[model samples]
Target: MRADADLDLLGVLVTRRGRLMEVATVLRRYGFASIAAQLDSAGGPGHRLVQRVTDRFIDPELASASAGERLRGALTELGTTAIKLGQLLSLRPDIVGPNVASALAELRAGVPADPPGHAEDTVRAELGADVTELFREFDPTPLASGSVAQVHRAVLHDGTPVVVKILHEGVRRRVLDDLQLLSALAVWSEAVSPIAHQLRFAAVAADFDRSMRGAVDLREELANLQRFGAMFAEDPGVRIPVAYPERSSAGVLTMEEMTGHVVDDGESVRAAGWAPDELATRTASIYLTMVFRHGIYHTDPHPGNFLLNPGVITILDFGDVARISSSKREQLEDLIAAVGGGEPRSVTDALLAITDAPPGIREDEVVDDVEAQITDHLTGGVDAIDLAAVTRGVAVVVHRHGLSLPAEIALVLRVVTLLQGLAADIGADIDLRSITRPFALDLARRRLDPKVRLGRAVRTGRAWERLAETLPGELSALLDHIRREGGADLRLRDPDGIADHLVDGLLTAALVLSAGELVSRSVPPKLGSLSVPGLAVAGAAWLRYRSIRARRAGAPSAAARLRLAERVIRSARRPGTS
Candidate 1:
């Protein structure tokens, strides 16, 4: 259901039949006619009409394509928003299968460079000056073009080499429109389709929309670059490009340009005098530190995003990043520790702590699968293990058990996968366990620190104090209700007529209450060898014992009854002469 204002907006779009028809035609061509038909049938606030057109004319080439391929092709054809969504989906192997994720990974935005003067115009508009005013030299030709922005080589007046990233004109408006359409479709699909509901289409769409919108704003990326630079300020091996905020704006970013050997090029890296294995290890260590210590990390780990210049590793592209919460980070630490220690139960518990598993999923099965995967991968030693494969294997098990990884964890897993791929490409043999073990151990030790334990105890004390303050009042209210009603309401399911035992329980409760009252009032001793309270307690215990004995004795023994019946039958046979 939409509000009046939303309805008006939808009406405006409906008036533009050309755009709607274009979207429908594209969907139909991409083997998604069923979805298009659903949208088309849901027209203008009335009852939805049945789609009578059974003949769907799909593209012949797409007829034999796998579902992943068709989806990849459809997203590629749908433009920037769809491309960004595909890229995000590529990181979510738990939501989508590995096959779909792999196929989506191959999806390239391939946005052609805007016309020559477009970049200059954007720069002028964003910085309030022509390129000549801001830089000593500006190249009009773009170095690269992405879905959101394009970069150009330039130099500041101080003669420092830099890159100017400029957002495309009208891209924000276009992306917003597409996002609105997608959201609307998602809502409708979730309402009508079981698969969409299961996949949580609306939630994923909202997250994707937010991510894409964030990516479109150059200011966000600039902030990320600055934060990452600060994080690695003391580390000499890792280099984050310097962001020039004075020369940047919401739609424009200026950063130091990096020129070096791409990390994926093994020959080039070796020629540059860097050992591939050592470089890989260092790279893993840096990322691991970011995740375990800082809790903020770059999500993308493709080789193009890394540059090996001289002795430093320069990271690029801050457009996509993820932040992990402290609790999630702790869970990840536990998971790492458990995996390293080869504790399957602990690993399962840690994973369950971080992810949401479906009801009725067998924890033992998931643990067994994970343990098997770990054993298979680590049997040859940690150095020979593939971190990405291990992570993927865990992801596969999670998916099989109908569990969903949190978005942050999914992105982390994606980064690990990319790093592993990069390592393999460079023929680098690095032990991920060795890199993570120290951090895990340190975290475990920190958890057991006296200060941490004291803090936890203080928090627990406060929680208990609160409960204590409320418990007395709650108990008083319950007693008041029982008194007013003359008895407590109780429900019981008793077979074998054992509910008769409740009479003895009632007597015991009465005796206990009486004894408590007598003890509180300091009643005089009345029994021969005990005080009044002690005698009452003794009588209650004796009554309980007698009740138990009576119940057991009253129940007949099958063998004794059978023998008595046989004796009666034998006596009757002896008198058969009569």
Candidate 2:
């Protein structure tokens, strides 16, 4: 039962359970030998006694484990923390490489039960009451044993059916220790490698710490379940588990046990008489709404969390939820708009700006490449393209640009990709983007409202005012004096001569003074046609004043300034620009 005991000893005891040797073999299959050797190498300096203890457990072939095998072994050896990391790596195939990440993703952290008596003792200790006094009926057998907790089915006094999630004994201490080690390693990696710039290893480790903390606490999980339930309360097709708040505790959570055929398999769905295409559409819609509209989404969308009813897609497990801010939501809207508009550069910029990606990437090239990929997806279709493909394509481009996908984008990508997998499972030929295009448009129009435009214009005017107020005016008076003296004679002088210098100073002063006056005399008029044309005329008058002064001095005609004035007039005519 000791965590640090020799694997061989555990193997011997597990042999009685028929898979002890197999489990030991799996654990030993990854870097166990090399790890032992590393320990041995360290032992020579100050820990000969410790080396002997570790040497006893070393297997010959473990040191030479393949990267995939080593990763799998780490999952087996470390338990919950490693399993969570492996699961995270599964969503980031581009960074981790497909083979190793796929192999690690297959690692499950299902554990053996503590003795029934021990489980009973732990549960009673947690609740400060005996099992019989606490519940009408308590199952001696565990319903499930995950890395962090084990579940037991029970009934409350009022006959409410619930599943009790009990935190494993000493799980907190163990998880904390492993997380600290991982955090240290993440920091060290960042200090020594270029990959750190792109991988953002430290941030990933910190997020993992937060995720593990949430996982170990039944209270947080309970709250998450409640939030999700409330979010889907009005939507019949999307079902979330209901928390039994009366019985929930920090270490133990009681919730309504969800039940349905496995949506992961097509056979179960077909048997349930649920149309696959409809189920896929419904699932996609629920997530799209959560991410694009509500800005909250489930981080994990693997098959284990999904169940299919006749017309419903039930979601379970609430340990990992991603919440995006309003700004991030807007950026996502911008990304969708850019893709729809076939502007790759905008999508790339928005991606870098919104997501906390690793730095040192060429923003321009990344944008162009992402644009090309998006264009291909948009154009390659019969009548419409799939959203799944679009999402995957975007993920791929961002990954290739050495940009790390923050948890928010990762979750968004995960949901869309999972939906794609579901579609394939249900025989749906739906294009994800096609179904979500209208949703994307609605988001855009809401964000790009007339009010938003007016706010932006007001902000720009304030900035222009600051620039104008910073200019000097004494020089303009001197230039005016010169103009009165001899307008044509001033232009005849060489440009580098004293007259030219004075003219340059005069023009600068005049422009600054004019801009300052325009900003200072701002009127509180309603944003209407009259106000816009008035601004245009003021702009024209300023330009005309400069032109007339220049012409009188026999200076070059103010052609460039005139052209700029015309452009401003055109812009002012636009409803939003004004």
Candidate 3:
């Protein structure tokens, strides 16, 4: 399906030849000539061809670099949008593989602060007041700055301390322009490149666009802050900074200031009377509750985003978060249970349920892979098991089997990986299985509850009812199109006696349907002292038996027919053949 926003963005890119050439030059410089060639071949204005011809220079230093390193370097050079894209790709091991994701994970969005005056100007423009009017004290110097926004320390009129986050001037336009270029390139790549098509580049670009756009808006961050704050309001050990929405806008955010030693500072934490082991366990518990219980969790929990303020763990940066649907939550729960149960089939089933694997993939192969991963992790007796490694291993297996995970799930896995890093930073030994086991078991038990079963049944019944209501119209439309296009549009290839087999299958289906109708009636005719429907079913059984027997007797099956057809086509296309 084509999204209107994507189409609009594509149009915008097409009209900007200068920008397209710049993109092409950058791609070529990064040793991505093939991608640039594909983009040029896909066509834009004449400048694309011109750029292709003139852009002959390649960086020799990048020649020895791995693809991931080259890509990371290119993105870092491209500024905010590309850096953000790299950061987003870092979360998707299923798409880019663990090695590439690890490389991209090193990308940091740290940029020099915008001019001190620019920050105040943004706040004044967004809040519709001078900096003096909005706060009793507004420090001109910035506390921190990044590609997207910068923060300033300020005090409210009532002596409440807060930090003001202001979006950089002209960032939205530049980022959007880059996103548009990316969207256009992805659309073109998907159309012309097999690898791009397989990866679904356009969809990935669309998702990235949505994510970057949302993150760019300070209002979304404010909302995330408020929601997380409410979720942990009763927990004395956790601290979520309070957001002042009244003073926040799409381009400006004001939140209560949180001051503490950074969580990764073990010496400071110890000085504050908090043991590393206990602190790590509490941190894990807080995140686990957010994920498995609340179903909404912060996606980035790096050491820099956490703080140790006496007894409280202060969480910062709600700019990025993820949510899990109820069904997906259940799938995750089942996955944890399956791993703990040490059953290959159950693990495989849970993995398949959570991913979008292509049809006809070998179930036994996936099962074997899952078994191997589970066994490898289990050998260490829970505490030694690295959740991040296991998760990355599963993703590798899934990718090997031509499966893809939904973006939300991929982000969740990324969160798990980050948690492992956080654990390492705090020098804490954790049993991931022990931490997650109760939530999984609780979800399993809930599934077995009578109330839950009844609710599932009702949901299933309603779903079936809706399908029944719509199926006829959909089938009718399909049949009408088939009839209108005639049989040539079927695009079937039959060899030898395969067409006869097709006829036989259709006849068998007709007989089965007729038999069903006849059996449903209150009264039915008799054939040789048996019900007519019974005779019809017996006839279908005989026909099926005959068909199977013929196949066993070397009569060409559909697959064999296809092979024969291919051989004939190849022969016909050979030299001096018609």
Best by TM-score: 3
Per-residue lDDT, model 1, residue 455, is 90
Candidate 1: TM-score? 0.76
Ranking by TM-score: 3, 1, 2
RMSD of each: 12.7, 11.9, 9.6
| Model with the higher lDDT, candidate 1 or 2 | 1
Stretches of candidate 3 off by over 4 Å are: 1-10, 33-56, 449-451, 463-578
1-578 per-residue lDDT for model 3 (tens digits): 33654565568776776767776677678766533333223335554665565445658777677767877888888788889999998987667766778889999988788875897778778888988998999998889988898899999999999999988888988888778788877887677555456567788899899888987898899989989989988989889999998889999999999988876556766866788777766777788899888999998888888878678899999988878888887777777777766678988898889877766889999888887865467666667777777887777787677677778678887887888777777677665666667766777688899998999999997785565344434433443453465423232544355554654554444444343333333334664477655765776677668667865785634433233323332332233321
Q: What is the C-alpha lDDT of each candidate?
A: 0.72, 0.65, 0.73
Worst 10 residues of 1 by lDDT: 569-578
Q: Give residue 539's error in model 3 in angstroms.
A: 13
The model with the greatest lDDT is 3
